[model samples]
Target: MKVSPDGQPTADVIARVKDIPLYREAVARGHFPVLEKAEIARGFPDNWMTPALAAALDAGEAEFVLSTGTNHARMQLIRPPYFLLKSYYRLWSTHPDIKETWEAGCRRVSLTTVLATEHVARVNAKKRGEEPRPDPRPADRRLDARTFYLNTRLDPALWERADVERMLAEMAEARQAHPQGWYHLDCSGYHLAHLLQKINKWGLWDAFSPPASIIHAYEFTPVNVRRYLQQHFACPIIDLFGSTELGYLFYSDRRGRYHPYLEDMSVELAPVTEGSGLFHLIVTSVRNPHMPLVRYRSGDCARTLDGTPDPAKIKQFSGREKELLESPSGPVAQGDLDALVGSVSPHVFVHQLRVLSPAEAVLAYTTFDGRPLAPRQVAALGHGVRELTGRRCVLDHRDHIAIGKSGKYAWLARDGK
Candidate 1:
């Protein structure tokens, strides 16, 4: 289905996006400028809030939530069954490696980064004139009493004693109805690592059943966290990539290599002018019947493995363009740091590398359970940074890596990004 030059979608495309008030003028002009966050956030509820969409929300056909990353509060969007479950029921539950969890009829548990709770708390606190306090412990595993996150995720700290007991009780009830001990652990890589750290500390490793698999999404997983999850969990650890505005786009195999999983969607990488070899993700998705965003700039960036702007060769989804750091070697993306950290050691749980000057840098890092890196490992980490950025560096062992005010991890932090 296509739109005519007269600024109208063919009978098919129009059947979905046309009646939407926000696209009325664009649809009439036979033109659709890319959907920017600012524009969508500015015209929200009024623009895309078509009668159909409104009806869907009221009738429980769709769920509403705000984007966590935006200049303003956030753009609200509606989804059918929320994005996560929508993707799972639509794609992941059927993948070869993932089919077992589905066939077992396992209970699905989601875990996102501890950052979400921390960041959402700060935002909510500011709104209520409450001062947010920093989590004294570096793990950032504490959950905010107030609810945060889209309807898609469970709280990061949901595995606490009371919660775990409750979960077991529910599983017991389910077993009584139908015998099944299998379950799926869905979470962010760091939170899974955090949960494992907590379990080890509490000596509760064997108290719980092994999951059929661990599905991690939401934020980019640190190399160390991914390694830890795989080593500790005797199950498939799958990595999913996508956003609330869009459904699942990509996922990773056990080797941590990403492969596209687009359905009713296509993607292309356009060279970003600020950083050579870096490209902004351009996606055309018609998957959602209500909001068929076409040629939308997703605001995320990545690099090609072979220096070609080919989606087939995408090395990494990297990070947001606004967060790109000006490195002595052009601009450093988060994926660049992730690669560097992986080279240093799999035990490096969390790291934040800041460029201090052309000749010097500092890396704040944490290891699994506060395990100190050997002098050789520290030397290797410093050497990797110097080789990549042409700068000598020093290591700073953080008691815990600090989460952004928004409860996100910035592997490459610069100028307070």
Candidate 2:
């Protein structure tokens, strides 16, 4: 069946869905329902396995992989090797703001979770029996000839002076390796912020090399973190929104305006709750030929500039659907609270909203400089929280916040959970 310019099939795409065992029964029932994770995991690869797919696997044309489990439990998936990296490179080479750097053959230095770095090392090793040798050298963590990994710890908040120094030295080496002495930085925005804080504390600016361009595609970066990066780096800071299952679908420009990159995909947004601005992202894509997703609920949420379903107007990829919270006014998303906090103070780095009771909550936060927020800023934050959640909020300051077991940070939690 031929697909339209917008990715909608002119004929029934269900024709293809019916071929897959997983959706055969649903198609036979004459009802094409939105696919969820539980249903996909019901029969494992047997449901999706075909003679041709098995042949592809045997020939090493496709492989099994697991999702990062950032927002939920890990999900098993099948795709061609380097599926995500190809998607990333396609965007980087064509994005108006970053194409010049990409075409220049710039080196990439990734600084994100240690889990991500370790995953790269494991994949590169190609052996699963024993753990890869612990090597602090960049060559051991190199993903490819053009890309290298930097961070080796689970949490950025716990990075010591030696950690900072080592990362800076490795980054300098990466920059020097480039013919132009410029390298591209790929990172989680939170990790970059932590690095910047440590660099400032130790006055290590000379040891670090500013990238020609930067992309933060790992997680939901708070608004303040983006602004903080702007103050330190003159390069373009782009935001990419996508997942492991689906390659990157959209990316932002230097001005923070998002543009769709759905070459073989389409997206629809459903309201998280009636009359609420937040929306759940439902995607249908043939990007991954091994496991084509049909109207898959991606478990991610977003918000539109005008609170409408226009994909072009998608202003923010807010947070995960599982992490959403309830309030008297409406549902509260991670981005909703992040915007409120950013407005109160740019000094706030990491934060978590702990719901104490139906009528009370606490906003715990840590500053960039290990100092508490001003009294006025704290009071403003409390007022803002109360207005947003219909609960009295107590502001608490701390020197550190913990990373999650998944190697990401949680923006909202309840009762120390």
Highest-scoring model, TM-score: 2
Candidate 2 residue lDDT tens string, 1-417: 233454343345666556789877776776556789987788889888977789989999999999988788888999999899899999999999999989999988999988888887777666545567676456668888888899889999889999999999888887888889889999999999999988888899889889999999999999989999999999999999999999999999999999989886878888889899889998888788888887789999999999998788999999998888888888899999999999999999999999988999999999877899989999999999999999999999988889987679989888856
TM-scores, all models, native as reference = 0.77, 0.95
TM-score of 2: 0.95
RMSD (Å) of each candidate, 1 decimal: 6.7, 2.1
Candidate 1 lDDT by residue in tens digits, 54-146: 888889887766666532246677667545556755565676678776776655554464445555556556656867655422112222321
lDDT of 2: 0.87
Candidate 1's clash total is: 5
Clash statistics: count for each candidate: 5, 0
